[model samples]
Target: MIYSEKVMDHFQNPRNVGKIEDADGVGEVGNAKCGDIMKIYLKVDDNGIITDVKFNTYGCASAIATSSMATELIKGKSVDDALQLSNKAVVEALDGLPPVKVHCSVLAEEAVRAAVADYYQRKGIEKEIPGCSGNCSCCHLHDEHCGGDEE
Candidate 1:
């Protein structure tokens, strides 16, 4: 399994690695088959900009790298813009990931959407999470995050 240099760098030095005690929103996702679990935290300003982002991941190098890159992509972006983030973009930002490890990027994307959904829910906003594929097991397990009926 060849990894990109960016992927290795991120794996060795994962960013935003801890939980935020006062996070405005939080999201968790896992792939039981691969045994990867990811949690994302966000602090959004009242103006709808993401002031900060963090993540905790337990898996292989790809999982940690993808989680780190996802945070970097969303921080300082508008909530709406952050919601537009996609796994393909994450993969591209990382230079790329091996075909088999691509699922880690999907987890990163889902984690971001889940955290934003939590933020919206906390603000009493009734809105659908953008970019939700509704195919991840996390969505079926945590319906509130995806706003979809569990499969």
Candidate 2:
């Protein structure tokens, strides 16, 4: 599979590649079929800005690269802005990935949403994460009102 230069760069030199011991929020997502897993850690300030972000990924180069790029894109951005992050944006930032590897980007996006959702839960804020399955460990909301994009 052909990989973009950006993808290769990120794979070789991933950014924010460790866990935050006291992270305010953490998210983990995976594709069982592909055996790819991504875990994201976030530290949010009192102002609702993401002060720090980190990730750990286990999978192909695309998975690692996407995770790295996702953290880089959201750092220092507000939680609201981070929620706007999509797999398409991650793919675009990486120049592109093999069609088969696109799912890695999707996992990266979901990981971000899951982390933000966890943040909300910790803060006692009632919020739903878009695109979340509501069945995942990252999302503690187990009600009929969970999951999917808001209309």
Candidate 3:
């Protein structure tokens, strides 16, 4: 599989490829099963602006490029704006991504959302987890409502 030149450039010379030791928030996503993992670090200013963003990823070239480009795109944006960034935008910014590798961009987007959510959580705000709203089954099941077993 040949990656686009844009993807190759970013992957070969990834920007913001390290961590922010004192990041305001950090997000980690994906797992062994998914064959990709991304860790994002963010530094937000008092005005809710993202003064800095960075990522460390273990995955394919597209995943690395997406993570790198996504951080670069959000570094100077407000947290809210950064959170609104979609995988499509990231893929488009990189020109385009192949179908099978599109999920890498999705992972990058999710990592960003996860980081912003972590920031809000730290600030005592509620987070809207995708597909798991309002006292999710996991929450109810683990909170003694199920009496430790379900018949």
| Cα lDDT listed for each candidate | 0.85, 0.86, 0.80
Please give each candidate's TM-score.
Answer: 0.86, 0.87, 0.83
Off by over 4 Å in 3: 127-151
Q: Write the per-residue lDDT of candidate 3 for residues 47-107, one digit (tens) a residue.
A: 9999998899988899899999999889899888988888889999999998888878877
Better of 1 and 3 by lDDT: 1
- Decide which is better by lDDT, 2 or 3: 2
Q: Pick by TM-score: which candidate is best? A: 2
At residue 11, what lDDT does model 3 achieve? 96
lDDT of 2 by residue, 2-39 (tens): 89999999999999999999999998877443467789
Candidate 1 residues lying further than 4 Å off, grouped into runs, are 131-151
Judge candidate 1 at residue 145 and give its lDDT: 44
Q: What is the model-wide C-alpha lDDT for candidate 2? A: 0.86
Highest-scoring model, lDDT: 2
Give model 3 RMSD, 1 decimal: 6.9
True-vs-predicted CA distance for residue 10, candidate 3, Å = 0.5
Ranked candidates (TM-score, high to low): 2, 1, 3
